[model samples]
Target: MKQELRKQFGDEFQYEIALNGNEALEVVDELVEAGVNVILILSDWLMPGLKGDEFLILIHAKYPNIRSILITGHVDESAAERVKREAGTYAVFSKPWDSTKLMEAVRICCNKN
Candidate 1:
């Protein structure tokens, strides 16, 4: 996915990766401290430590401006709905998502930011 993102976006945007929710939070804090204007997040619903929905909600509470897109291989409809309603997730994509649609969504979200 990272490779795909790099291929699509090139150097237009800076990309960061974290292994788990805790690491992702730390990375976000570091980026914020460095004055990085984080505009979007793409997270999987099933993660090691913190679930993606939970993580997105926490992030939304702290940084409402940061748009999120949730990707999941297996998640209940209610959980997806909860993320959209509570976290204001921009979109949710299942595994094996269409790259074109994902890229389009990212472009729209970035443009809005």
Candidate 2:
């Protein structure tokens, strides 16, 4: 997935990978220290530790400017609403996402004119 994203985004964007939410937090910290401003996070809902929505909420609390997208195969309506209302996510995509739509969301959320 990272490779695919890297191929799509190329060297224009910095990408970070983590095994779990905790590691993701650490990576975010490292990026901040390294003077890299995070623009977005694309995460799976069934992550190892914290769920995607929960993780995004956590990140939003600290860095409200950062945008988020949740990609999951299973999502309840109420959970989706909660994440949207609470996390301020850019959008939610089902599994086997459409690359064009995903990129469109990214552009809309991160670079709206």
Give per-candidate clash totals. 0, 0
Report how far off residue 37 is in candidate 1 (Å): 0.3
Write candidate 2's Cα lDDT for 1-113 as tens digits.
67776766677777788878888888887888888989988888888989888888998898888888888899667767777889898788988899888888876776832
How well is each residue in 1-113 modelled by candidate 1, as lDDT tens digits? 78888887888889999888888989998998899999999999889999999999999999899999999999589999999999999899998899989988888888932
Q: CA RMSD for every model?
A: 1.5, 1.6
Deviation in angstroms for 89 in model 1? 0.2
Candidate 2: segments with Cα more than 4 A from true spot: none
lDDT of 2 at 67: 86
Please identify model 1 stretches exceeding 4 Å from their true place.
none
What TM-score should be assigned to candidate 1? 0.95
For model 2, where is the 10-residue window of minimal lDDT? 104-113
**TM-score of the candidate numbered 2?**
0.90
